[model samples]
Every structure is written in C-alpha cells, then in structure tokens.
Target: MEQTTKNLVLASIGNIYEQSKSSSLNAGFFESADADLKLVSEYFGVTPNQALIVAMVFALNYKGDTVDIKDLTEFFECNPLKMLEYSDDFETLFNLGIFKKIKSTHRMKLSLANDQFIINQKITEAILLNRAMPVVEKERINDIIELIEELYKLGKQVDDKEMESFELFRHVSSMLDTNAHFPLVKKINEFEFTTTDTYLLLYLIWRTVNGNEATEVGRIAQGIFSSSSARINFVQDIINGDNRLISENLMEVVEAEFFDDTEVKLTANALTLIHEHGIKLFGKKKKSKDLIEPESITVKNLIFNEFEQKQLDFLYSTLSDENFIATQERLEKKGLPKGITVLLHGLPGTGKTETVFQLAKTTGRSILKVDISRSKSMWFGESEKIIKRIFTNYTEYTKNCDRTPILLFNEADAIISKRRDAGTSNTSQTENAMQNIILEELENFKGIFIATTNLSKNLDTAFERRFLFKIEFNKPSLAIKSQIWHDKLPILLQEECDQLASRYDFSGGQIDNIVRKAEIHEIIHGIGVNFDNLLEFCNTELLAKKHESNLGFSKK
Candidate 1:
C-alpha cells in the first residue's frame, strides 16, 4: 500500500521486463540487473533466477493465459528449445505455490513445453499491491486426529499426482518439526527414527486413521524412496518385517495373499501410543460397506399396514436423535441400562430389513450391519472372539459418533434361533458361547441395537427378555400393497397396481424385484412398460421363493 514499495516493485518489474526482450538471458544476465534482482529476491525470498522468472510471468498479458516455456519464445527472444533450460526454475516456482500448474498431459514424464503454468492469483495480488510475499504460518495443531487428517489430505494430493511425493514427506516432516506443541511430536521425537522410518510411520498412521487399510505398500515405498532399487529393497524389507517400521512395532501388515497386494497399518501398540497423546485417530468407521450410511438406504416411501406402521412409528420416535439422547440420560440417572435392543421379527422379503434401513434413514443414523457368516469361524473359540469384537467395535463407534449407529444384524435367524445343548457337540458349544457373548454385550450396551430375524419363534429365551421393542413385519394388506406398487413405480396406474396387488402375494422385496425387472426390460428391449410386462415380470419373480439359510461349511 506504500508509494515507496510500489515504486520499488514497478522499477524491478520494468527492469526485468526490459531485460526479457534481450537476444538471450546469458549466464551473467541476472548479475547485470543486480539492484532489481536483489530487490525482487528480498521481496519474494526466492533465488535471483526464480525472481526473474516470476517477474517475467507477472509482466505477461493480464488476461493470465496459462503459459508454457514454448509460449514465452516471443517475449524472451529465444527459441522454445532455449526456454526449456529454465524448466527447473519454473518447476521450483510452481512447487513453491507461486505458480499454479494448470494441467498435466499424461501420467508419464513430460517436457516443459507439455506442461502449462499460470501465476497463482495470491502471488499476483501481492505483487500488484507492492507488498512483500505473504507468510501464512501453519496453525499449531494440538490434536492427534487433526494432525492425521492434515497428513491424509496431503497424502491424497500425492496420490492424485497434484504434488510431488517428496514434497508430501517434506511438508509433513517440516510441519511436525515446527509445531512441536503437541505430545504426538514429542513421542515421535522419542522414537529417534530415521527419515525413511519416520515417513513410513506417518504414512501408516494416516492410512489407518483414514480407514484405508488396503493402500499398496509399493506405492508408499515409491514415494519415500527415489531410487528404483532402493524402493524395491525397502518394500521387501517392509513385507518381510525387516524395516524399522515393522521391527519397532510401529506398523503391521494387512493380510493379503499376494506380494503386490501387500499393505500396512498402525499396530495396536502404535494406536495405543497415539491414544496416550489425548486423541484417538483410529476407531471403527461407521461408514463402510457393511456399515451403511442412512442416506444410501433406498427404502423410500415405505408403506406398512396400520398395526405395523404404529409399531414402527413408536420405534422411530424412540430412536430419534433428541429422544434417544434424552431417554438414555434419564435411564442413566436411574442406574438402568441405557441401551435399546430392538427385535424386528417377521417373514423374509416382508420389509423387516427394509424397515430397519428406513428407521435409520429417518433417524439420521448409520447401520452397522452384521455379517453372520464371517462372525462364525471353524476354529474353536475364534467365533466367540469375533462376536465380542463386533460388539466392541460398535461400542467404539458409538463413543466417537454424534448419533450412535444402529447395530443391525439383518436376517439374523442364526443369532435369534434357540441355542442347542452345549454338551451335544463343539458346534453346540460355540453357538451357546456366541449367544452368551451377545447377552452380555446387550447388558452393557449403551447405544441403539436392532436385529431383524425371520425365525423369531426360535428366539433364545434370554435374548427375548433383553429386547426393549419387538416390532413384527407382517405381509402387507391388499390396499397397502397397491399403494406400495404405485409409490415404488409411479409409472404404474392405480387400477393396474391394485389388480397386480390383488393377483400376487408379493412382499415389498418382490415388488422391488419387479420394478427392477421392468426397468431392465425397458432398457434392454426399448419396450414401453405395460401392465402385461409387469405381470410377466412378477410371475417369473418367484423361483419358488425359498427361505434363505445361513448354513455353510467353513472354508479350508
């Protein structure tokens, strides 16, 4: 804003702009413009050559066209080949965030001619206002999760090829070095890790915090090591547990069958160390494949008969965020269990699971769906441990989340079925053990838990007492079914929908199948949907609708 600063900047730009028309910017060219070069360097804190490059870029057409070295031939009075020599300076300025990299031609290495650049707007503003370079200090991050989030963002930049891999390592290392207010830094400093080990540890922590357990190890090693042989050797060391990251108990491998598919994550000890520093970055993610986000649930405009709808309305009210929190608080005051275990029992395809999803969606909660097959293992005692971990993980999710998620055991016939005598067989013992773990978890559970089962009649007596809400999903009435058909496929006429509803004893799931089939028919055959097409699709929908069984042998 000062006149003196404006005069100095104008003088420097005039000097550089005049020199740019030279026949050539020879070896001693910057030396000749000593006063201008020195002033530019002092203002921007860049090298003389970098300052000259920036000044030249600033003097370009104000429209701010993305210019490559080839495009500067006319202004510099030099050939495109000659301008290529300044690629390193251009690249350096671009990396410093003074120049914006507009795009890349290909994934492979490209010439300076192929690369495009434009002056970063902030840099242009500062220069135009005749102000010194802006020094934006990185905020001192005291939270461990915040630090990991920052690293994760930068790591993504590297993954997207927006940044150099080495820059990510340098930026993170420098950030922690400068902002040493947090205990994480102190703990990391205590490790006394070498640069490579430090980078590996940080990368694993970021990946773990981001719930990216399957990040390729080679891609990370490639980022840490420039030399091809060194990268390969270090990756081998990582996979073989020879690297300091693995040997020091800072990281562990994510089990994968192939070497190329190998990945790594923070070890339990490493997670504990992170926790000791006042923030826990690693917890069970509530938004994953098995854990469904409420928005993604497709059970919209769900229709149920009067009795079922009333039961569902009550359940939804109880699970509503504000209501649930208030109920939990009052229950806690009375020294009662704050958990609400819900039993959604009904016939298959009768909207039991769909109702659960709808409840979660309406209540703005996530569903941590249980995979029963995976819960049971062939190995003795592992089944119980798996069940315990599922509950344990859910507990962590509830603590970290704003609204506690619903732990949904969809189609949970195996879980709700009566347990056999433990003395009969090892399988019986395992079943009893899993049931016992569930009973105990329910006793201590402090969040929303819902399990949908078709075989409610076989319910274990103990779990029956634990359920606070039991909502049965019976087959829809004819009127409700007709409404559901019209709602699901708005293209269907009310009379047609009513006729179809009157004809077939279909559940909501079966109707969904028909809608999907009609869509597919229209797409594949370019046929306009008709009632006959709907009827045909409906007729074929039942391949003798059999009850889904959860009986399968363990993989060898």
Candidate 2:
C-alpha cells in the first residue's frame, strides 16, 4: 500500500459513511478497510499511511461527523494543501459510493447519520473478513505464510506485512490452521464440501509447497481446477483423502471415469499428475494405449470437402505407416539422424493447421504449436532454449507414453524462410539454431512431426530434404468449394450455395468463415440468408486476404 492507496481507502470509507446516512442505512467501514487493505497489500505492498487513513476514516465517520478534506487533514495532522495534492486518489472511493460532486457549491458534506454509518461498517467488515470470528486458526495463518514463503522461494517478491497478516490470522485460530495446513485432508471431512473447494484446497497446497516433487500435487490440483464442467462428474469419486484415493481407488476411478478400458490404466488425472510430478508412489507405468491419440481432439462437427479430406487422409496415412517406423528403427540402428522435418506447404486458409491437427488426432499425439515470431530473441542463445524446451516436452511425452508426440510448427516460413541480407545476424543465428534443433530431434524421433508454411519456396533446400514427406495443400477446386458450401450451410441456403461458391475462389477454411459470418449477421440483424450479406462477407474476407498478402510482401 502506497500513500495514494491509503488516501483512496480513507476516501472510500468516508464516502460509504456519507451514503449510509443519506439512505438511513448503515455502511460497512471495516469491510471496506479490509478489502482496500487486501487489494493494496496484494498489488503495492504494505503502506502504513493506507492503514492509518483507513483507521482514521473509520473513526471519524463512526462519530457521525461529515467527513471533509480539512477534517481528514487535521486527523492525520497533515496540511490541507497536502490533502488537496492527493485528491485524485479518492476518485475511486467516490465512484463506489453515491458521493456527489458539488461543483457549484465547492463543498463536501455528509448527508447521512451516525447509526447508519456503524451498521454499514459492521456489514462491510462481515463481508470483507468473510466471517465474524476474529480468531482464525493458527495453522491456517502459518500455511498462508508458508505459501508466501514458497512463492518467495520461487523468486516472487511479496510484501512482508502481507505474509505477516496471514501468519497472524493463522496463529489465532485452530480451524483456520487445520483448513490451511492440509486443505485436501480437512476438506474431505467437511460434509458439505464441493469439488470446487476440494480443487481450491489442492491449488493452495500446490502454491504453498514448492519443489519438483510437489508437481504431482500441482497437476492433480490443476486437473480438478479447470473451467470445463464435464471433468467434475468424471473425477468425483476417487478424490477421498484416504489410502484408497492413492492407489487402487485411483486406478479404478481412472478406468471408470477417464478411459473406457483398463489396458492403459491411466486416467487423465493420473497422466496429468505423473507428467508434472513424475510418478510419485507408483513406478513409471508404460502406456498400453497412445496418450496422444487422434480421437482426443474433437472434430465431429468439423465439415470438410473431398479435396481437404483427401489431403488429410494422405498426411494421416504417411504418419501412420509401418514403413515410417521401420525407417526410424533403421536410423536408430545406424545412429539417429540430425533432424526429420516434414513441411506442409500450401496457400493460406487451405487447411494447413487443420491438416496438422487432423494428423495429430489420427496419430495419437499432442500438437505443441511453435510460434516462430515470438520465439525469435535478440539475446544470444535464448531463442535456442525456447525451441529446445518445446522439443524437450515432446520427447518427455513420447518417453512417458511410449509414443512420440506430434510437434506442429505453424508459420514455419517465419523461421525457415530463405536467409535475407537485411535481417540481423541475431535473427539469422536464432533461425539456424531453431532449424538445427528441429533436425536433431527429428533424426532420432520415432514419432510424427509436421510444419505448415504458406511460402514453400521461402524454406531452405537443405531443410526441405530432411522432411520424410513434403505435401502441397492446394486451394479447393470450384466444385469442391461448391460441395463444401452446400454441406456446411443451412439446408434452406442450398439453392444459393452454388452461386456463392462460383463467385469466390474460397478455400475450405474461407468457406467455413463465410458461413460463420452469415450466421452472425442473421443473429444480429434478425434477417434470413440473402445474396447481398453473403457477397459482403465474401468481399470482407477477400479484402482481409489482400491486406495479409500486402503485409507479407512488405515484410519481405
């Protein structure tokens, strides 16, 4: 908390007090102070003035006196000019309450009474503290302090007072300590506890406990903490804080909830935890089934034309072949190759990413998309580390599941583009290192890898030969586009689909976008599908494509 925050807190309290009086209701001074303190402590550290101002405002407003700048200045033993200098600090407080600015009168006065102020204070305090019990469990406070300590250990610099406050709260109460120390343990005992609370406690434990060993706890915590509602019911049963939750129960739960069969015996929870913490109680279990399977990526609603389907089928078959495996084995016997790069060159919006995704889906692999632009670094060797990390993750996943994960290098032209004289040495070096790492990883890789680039000619010839396959994804033919439009759009729009498809040389992705835009337009304007709206949408996409082409050319 800075002086500015303190002034704001005080101003907020004062405004709340005045508002309470006008409505003949009580304001929450304690609650307001606690909230202000928590926010300020979290963001700007602890400032005594902020704390002091809060205390003063509470005290003055509690006495039913109209809070003015002069009164606040006197209470703080500060000059009026000093208060005026920091007047802007109170604007947030003023907005939160119903404090009106008397621009014509030039005076600030409270329109409410004292009793209302006290009531408001009590309510606010109750809401802020979350309960009336002042003495929180000592262990809870310790746990919070310990959590802060862990964050500090991880190089997070937090305010000393913030840590101290949590410590103090924990010291005063037993239940709080019990709740904080072993959140998962105690949360299990709470009869009314929900999965959200269970996950939250797990998160708290992970945040508090810092170590490589604690990663399993973190992953288990994260699995239970996602926004996806579907996961809750699935992960519900084996969550008890008993021995059953650890071994047999977890295995059973995994089979029953996550996977259809027991052959793999690995649940999403188990996989997530194992990946993070590295198999804690159990010895590393070999994956019987592919962890990164094609079916894992939901594509049931995705519509594609025959041409797009053929391209996807070709890529999928190439990756899935026994020949590829034999080749990798032969390479390994001879000693691993430097890199195995597969390039998917095509026009923009021609399903490069979708094809990559489809391959990942079919091959049972996770696609770690490489953002080449962001990966480029000015600092020597830094970009290499980022690239290495991506490959390292892929390697680890492959090793864990006994299947190599797919690495999707999107926008590869940015990295693999032919060297230009204008680019900095740093840029060239970074690109070379990225290419080198790709080469190194692929040479020994038993898994599938794909890179999508719009500009095939921009890539180095040496790099091109490293790829096991180079697939060219061409724009959909007019007939293919017509079929895509007919299949994707509503049944009522069938007659118009052929005319629309003939009008624009759209790719599969572009056709999808056109339909999506039409749907949005229908929803917004409350109109049926019309030629004018469809044409406008097509024109919009064409303009966007032109703009991107111009930008790409300009960059070159």
Candidate 3:
C-alpha cells in the first residue's frame, strides 16, 4: 500500500465520522494540507469522501428538501474541498434526479430525490464485488459498510423489510429480467394446469414472445380446431376451474372483453410461465386486425411480364423509407394525403390476389384480408355495422402496430360494383348503406388500402376516384407464357414449350392448375410429364370451366 493513498483514505473516513457527530473542522487549516489530497483525487477522480457526503445527504433528509453546500461542509466537519473537489459527481447525480436543486432559490443547495437505501446497497456492491479497487483502499471499506448498515436500518423501519431484502438479493442474483418475471411469477408456475388449459396458456405466451402481432378470437378458435362458440365455452371452463387458467384471480386476463372478438395479447403471468417452464407453443400468432400475417412469397416468386414487373417495382419503391419520409416531410406539408391507395383489377387466377400477398411480403407490411362474404348480414342494418366495425378495428390496430399494414379486399366485386338505385326493398337499403360506409372510410383513410376485383367495369366511378394507383393485370403475353411453361416443367423441351405457349391463351393461375394436374398424373403413372399428358390435363381443366353453369345473370 502506498503511504500517501493510505493517509487520504483514513483522512476521508475521519472527516465522515466527525460529520456523523455533528462537528465542524478548521477549513483554512485543511486547505493548506491539500497536497496529498490532490494526488489521491488525480488517481480516483472522486474520492470515497465525496460518495459519503452524498450518501449522508440522502440518509439524513427526505426528498425535495433544500440543502446548502456550505451547510454540508460545516456538517461534515471538513474543508470545502472534501465536498467541492467532487462537485461534478454530485452535479451529475443531481441531473439524474438522484438529487435535485431549485434554480431560483439557493442554487448551490440540493435535495435528495432517489432512494437512499438503494444507493447505499449499490455502493456496498461496488466495494464488495469489485476486485479492481486498490489494496491501499481495502482498510477504508468499513466506512462504506457502516453507511450501508445505517441506511438499511432506516429503510426497514419505513418500508417492507422483505421487499427491501428481495431487491438487494435480486440485484445480486439477477432473478428478475423484467418486472414481468418478478415476485408474483412463482404463483403462476405453481399451478397444475390441465392438458387442454396448458396448451392454450402456452400458445398465448409463445405468440407474445415471438410475434408482436395481435391475435383475434377467430384465429384462436381455428388454432384449437374448435368452433368460435365452442372455443368460448372452453375458455369459460378453464376460468371456472379450481386452478383457473384465464381468470382475474391469476391476472391472465385483465378484462372479460379480451376473450371475445377483440385482439388478444399474452398477459405478464403467461410470459412468466413460459420462462419458468420453457414451454414452446407451435402455432402462427394471429396478426393484428389491420395487419395480415406476412406472406410466405417474396418478390422473386412473382412471375409478371416486363411492364407489370416495372409497375410493381414502382409500387415497391413508393413504399420505401426514403419516399415515405419525403411524403411525410414534403408532400404532407402542402396538405396532401400521406397514404397510398391502390386498385388491382383483372381476371381471377391472373395473380391479383397473390400479387397483394407478395407486395406486402416484399415491402415488409402485414395484409388485412377483408372478406366481403363474411361482412354481409341478413339483418337489415347489420351489414353496415359490420363494415363500420372493420374500419374501426383497423384504426385501433394501427395505433398499436409498428408498421402500417395492407388492407386487402380480394374479389371485391360486390362492394366495388355500381350501386343500384335506392328502392323501398330492405336488400337495396343494406347494400347502399354498406357502400356509403366504405366510401366514407376510404375518403378519411390514412393507411395503405388495396382492393382487387375481376370485374372493374362494374366498379362505381366515385370509388375509383379514391385510388391513387389502378393497375390492370392482363393475361400473360406469349413470351411470358413460354417462360412460365418452361419454368414449371424444366424437363420439357423448349420447342414443345413454345408450341404450347403459342396454342394456349391461359392466365398464370390456369397454367399453374394445369401444371399441378400433369405433375400428379406423372407421379401416379410412373412416367415423365410428357406433352400428351400435359395436353390431357389442360383439356380437363378447360372442360371443368366449360361445364360450370352461370350462377347469376351477367351484370348490365
């Protein structure tokens, strides 16, 4: 141990002992004896004396009380340098709200704001656990220990002793990773959950850990292979049990409303259960109502012609970060709408729906699939209510989501079709009501909305005006057909593929169907997918379409 460092440590401790006894030192006398202090301060930056001064302030007073620096020096029985030399540390602590001061009244004075017990406990840890402290400072560890003991005694008198103890050991043991995994977590793990209840519990936890998207009741019903009504009954059964899995008693569900149509997230208890037992729930988490799950297809999976591909590239670029930021910063400054609304119109199986999925996957957004059939209601005004609910859910969803999701209205012929003149019939009124709600929602819409339809001719002009980009997906060109044929059947000769492409005028979807049939036949017959088998499959597909009867008269 260096003689000078030892003297500085002992001297600092002596000063604190005098302060505890409410005595004062000769300030001018210690000012002349500051040589060794400078050497120690140069090495340590802030000495134990300074830490003790701050600790004593915290220990002796309540938060927000005015404390004077001059008073602190007098109370500590030391020259002002003992407290002033490390004023920077105190200033930093003050800024961090460990201590605070009034700007107008006595600016040099400060008051403690942070808990004294916690600070002392951390200081105790620094002395006990840290191996890097100089050996010369080892004898002075008793001073820090005495301060911690005093703080602990004071803390236990006013607060929960067990909780304070828990905080101290929990810091040392690293027991709680998050507040979600703390004191009450063991209560959930103690339950003996039933097999069915356990599956539901783990499934919710797994979704939260891996997928941040919202999970709806319909999706949870589908996941458990039960009807929605039956799923509700199952949940009720669990909540009614002695060891309730989804009850307020366990805090697994904060509200009863969460188990219904609302999107659900895992409660803190569920998270704790997964960590404690290490259970893995294997199912896709339902995306938030606005967000559709990410599509499995990438842009590379999209097989469009040169013109269509370029159009898609433009759409993708429009969704890029640079353009979005520019729109928010520049165009939005001029009061223009900040969102993009696109309409994809073409024949079925022409990749309109798949394109939406691929576009969402490429641009990193979720898709919200709007089912027109599901939205329809037999009751007079119920259909309009459903449509409005869709928009309301979407608005609520965006508030919680990280990225804006694509709202997909696939095969939207019913909604986008021309509105019939209003008559006294209930059906006509319901249709008009739904269209009105949709129009209003679109006008006010601020997020990405995409609608695809086979019959764009029937689309109302008013609805068409709302779309910023309307892309017409036509049948594949001859060259594209050849590419599709070759790509689907790599074993086929180029000449045969060219001949097929020339003879057939098929959409990508029809070609995909034909190829699938041919591949199946080849597997069953133990033969290569030859030209003859391909033609047979193609004829069968065309025949199926021909035999189908018209379910409704062609729209006027």
Candidate 4:
C-alpha cells in the first residue's frame, strides 16, 4: 500500500480504461469493455464494468437511476461512461439475470433506456444477513412468526416504504438476540472499528458470500472509499503509510500484487476485522459446509513391515509437539520452510492412501482429503484458480484450527504430472500454472502436507524437491502379505495364509478385497469359507486388474 505502488496500480487500471474508452469513441458507439474489464476482472471473475457497477450500487445504497454518473466520475476519477456505460451495462447484468430492473417512472435527461435495478430476492436476503439462518422445526417456525408479530406491534410505526426494510432488520435482530451468534463474530465485535473500515469489511464479506476470494483493491476504492477527489489516496491511507487503519502486522490483512504474473489473492483481512466490530450494514458471513470428519482408522491395528513401521514411528515422533515444536524454531532460525511435506508414491493398491489415514489417526490430526480430479476444470484458466483457492482455503483453515489438519492430496498425479511441453494449448498452460502454485505454496507452507501418487515418474522435478520426506510404498513383501491375510480373514490357518501369500503377488488392498469377496460368497451361498472359492475370487481380481491394464499384458 505504498504511495508508489498505489499510483502504479491506479495508472495501470486507468490506462486500460482509457483504451476501452478510446475504442468506444472511435466506433461512435459503446463497444466491448473487455480491455479495461479484463485488467480488473482478472482478479475477480466479474467483468470490469460489472465490478464497478456492483461497487457503485453498494456506494449509492442501491439507488436505481438516481445514481449520478457525474458524482461517480468525480468521486473515482474516471470517465462518465466508465461510471455508467449507459444501457450496455444494465443489459449485460440483466442477461446474467442476477439482477431485476425496475423501470424508472420518471423521465431522465441523461440518456436512453430509463430503468433502475436491484439484485434478486435471494441476494437481498443474503445481503441482509439472513442467509445464514439455521433450520427450525415447523412448530418452532410458528412460534417465531408469532413472536415477530408481537415485536412488530410493540415497535414504533413507520411509513409503508420503510416498513418492509425495518421489519426484516428487526427479525434479524430478534434471531441474533434469541440464538447464540457465530463465535467468530462475537469475538470480533469486541474491537472497535472506524465506519469506513466497517463498510470495506462488509464488502469483503459480500464478495466471499458470492464465492469470490477477494475484490481488487483499486475497484474496491472506487466503489467504497470516502472523499470525492482523492478517493484512491484515501484507500492508500486506510491500508498503507503511517496512521494506516489496516496493516498486515496489526490487522493480519494484505493488499498483495502478483509481480512476474504469478497469481495473487489479496484479502484485506476485511472479514476477520469486520467480525470483530458488530456493524450490520452489510450481510453476515455465509455458513460454510461442515468440515468433513476424517476416517477413523485404528492405527494400532494396522500392519506394516519393519522399514515402513520405522518410518511411521519416526513420522509420529516428529509430528508430536515434544520434537516438532522444538525443531520448528530451529528450522525457522535456519530460514527453511517449517512445513512437513511428505510424498507417499508407489504402485496402486499399495496402501499409500491408508498410510496417510493412519498417520492422521495416530497423530490425532484430521485429514482434508483432496481429490485431484475435483480440482481440475475443462474451462480455460479456471483450473489454476481452483488450485490457488484450495491453498488459500487451507491457509485460512490452519489459522483458525486448534490443531493443524493434514492436507492429503490423493491421486495427486493428475495435478503434479510432468509440466506439459511448451507452446501447447491452454490446458497445458493451466497444468503448469497449477504446478507453479503448488510449488510456491509448498515452499511457504507452515503446516503438514502429504501427497500420494501412484505415478511418481509423472511428477514434476520441482515438486519432488519440495517434499521433506519421499517414501515409496512398494507392494507388500510375502511375509507382510501373509500377515494381512491372517489379519483380515482370521479363519485361515497360518500355513494356508503363507501358501496364498507366497503364490500370489498381491498388495494388501487386493488381499483385503479378495477376503471381502470370499466373506460375501459364504454369506450368500451358505458355502463355508472354501479355499477353492477364495482362490477363484483372487483369480477374478487379478483378471480384473489385467482388464483394466493395471498389470503387464502378454503379446502372443
């Protein structure tokens, strides 16, 4: 937020806008705003015009056509068309159909297509801080309605126009009063905040509600900052310089810019700070999905070889506070990344995934399993955003979590694959970008991260070096396989288990699967656990693997 940095960003944004305006004027009609919008929209997914319009709506308190283009231009130091963009802006928003247009009954001298706009009903509910409401039973709903009615009657009379807004506010107030509010908000509101700080924070919360990580600092200033002429300067003062209201060290917020074209997510620490102050002009934080519970695998009962067991024992010891906390200080002193990143790579069905689960269970850490396929997208540039968002979410999660959870990227080969050859399509570019983000995040990570991949050969060289520990999970040894068989199907004699384990080159997972099939066969057919049936199931499993091209095929 330095003066030089602020001026540079403003200049860059203004240059893009000037080009957009020039193009519009040359054609003698309002044309594509892509050039300007692209610059700002690159950060947020919305078009530049759309971002500007949304900010304006919030600034003008959702006034329809009553919003003044001249005032907006003077306030943000932009052209009138950039402020309004006339009918093109409204039409585009309408086409997106997230907003409803209210026809202006009164004629205006400014231009054509006189209409006002407000967002959808659901959006209004969300904006009003009612979207995070917990579900109640039918009987409780009736009681709540009756209570609201009683409260309404007791309240002072208001005009019909203001009545609806007042009632909604009162209802939200009643709900917060009756129920236990969000713990974070309760704790956050204890700190005092300036009015401008409260508004900016509300805007940040609004963006998150709409699934955006953060809004562009420049656009945010144009939309929300006070002062008509030097609005951008005010934003700089609020964030940077001496007497700044929001700073990284003091508020744990940031206004980051990604030089070298690396993606950056800048959150103004708006939500956290806003939550501290109980200003309700903007909507409350939307309730996120409940954190998925980690699988409860009994680590004590898990089987492993001498080397594997030793590695796991060492892992558990290091993860424990007695060693880890002490060593972390030393690592920081040495200027090395303090995160413990482990790569568990090897053959399919080799217990790589299970090992991660057991490690979490043993260490009393929760596992956030990342499915690589889910993070990918067919759209251009979207995959990279998804990867960046994942890391950002993880950073936030670690900040608030009591014990940092292990981020397990399962079947990670899909993402950590060898960087695509240069000059390929956007898909290849996105894949490389994804790897870049992962690599950078790994370098800076301060929590535990574990990645499992069957195809280690496909992994990028850069990623290999980032992992603190690289453990290969090869197929279980004969003795270990025999132990697995006896453990899973205890009915089998040791001799029989040894014969099966010795004859078949199967992983622990394959052995477990075969045992499960044998158990199901016995249950369905009342055929007591037969060796022939178990062997037959093992043969089918092997054949299925061959059919899937997982095993080597013979060319006759």
**TM-scores of the models, in the given order?**
0.56, 0.45, 0.48, 0.53
Ranking by TM-score: 1, 4, 3, 2
What is candidate 3's lDDT per residue for 328-414, written digit by digit as tens?
567578887766889999878788988888777867777778888878877556688678767755654454456677778888888
- Greater TM-score among 3 and 4 belongs to 4
Please report the candidate that would top lDDT against the real structure: 1
lDDT tens digits, residue span 1-556, model 1: 5658867876897788787675477656656787898888778788887887777777773545666675578777676677767778987786677777554444333345445677777766776687767753223576766776677666666556655555656667766776567777788888788766776777777776666644688888665554578668987887777877678876766555578887776655676676677756635553568878877877577888888888888888998888998999999999999999899898888888777888888888888899887788776676886787678667656666778888988777886689998799987888888988889989888888889888889998988889999988888889999998999888878898899889899989889899888888889999878888887788777545532332466456
Global lDDT of each model? 0.76, 0.51, 0.58, 0.59
Cα lDDT of model 2 by residue, 1-556, tens digit: 2336445544555554343332311134334445554543333222423333334455565577545555565554544565554344343233323122212123222221110111134323543544431222112224433443433322211121122222222222323333454443343445333434333333333432332222222233223323234233333433333323344322222111223221112333433443353223222432322233555567633445565567556656655646447667777778766234578888998777776676666566666566677676665665775676566545545555544567677878866677555366666667777777766766566566778899997887666667877877778777667777777765536557777777888888888888888788889989867777778888998997667766634552
The local lDDT score (0 to 100) that residue 270 gets in candidate 1 is 76
Tens-digit lDDT track of model 4 for 448-505: 8999989998888888889988887778888998998889888889998999999899
How big is the positional error of residue 550 in model 3, measured in Å on the Cα after superposition?
13
Once fitted onto the true fold, the runs of candidate 2 whose alpha carbons sit more than 4 angstroms away are 1-296, 300-311, 318-341, 421-425, 490-495, 525-528, 543-556
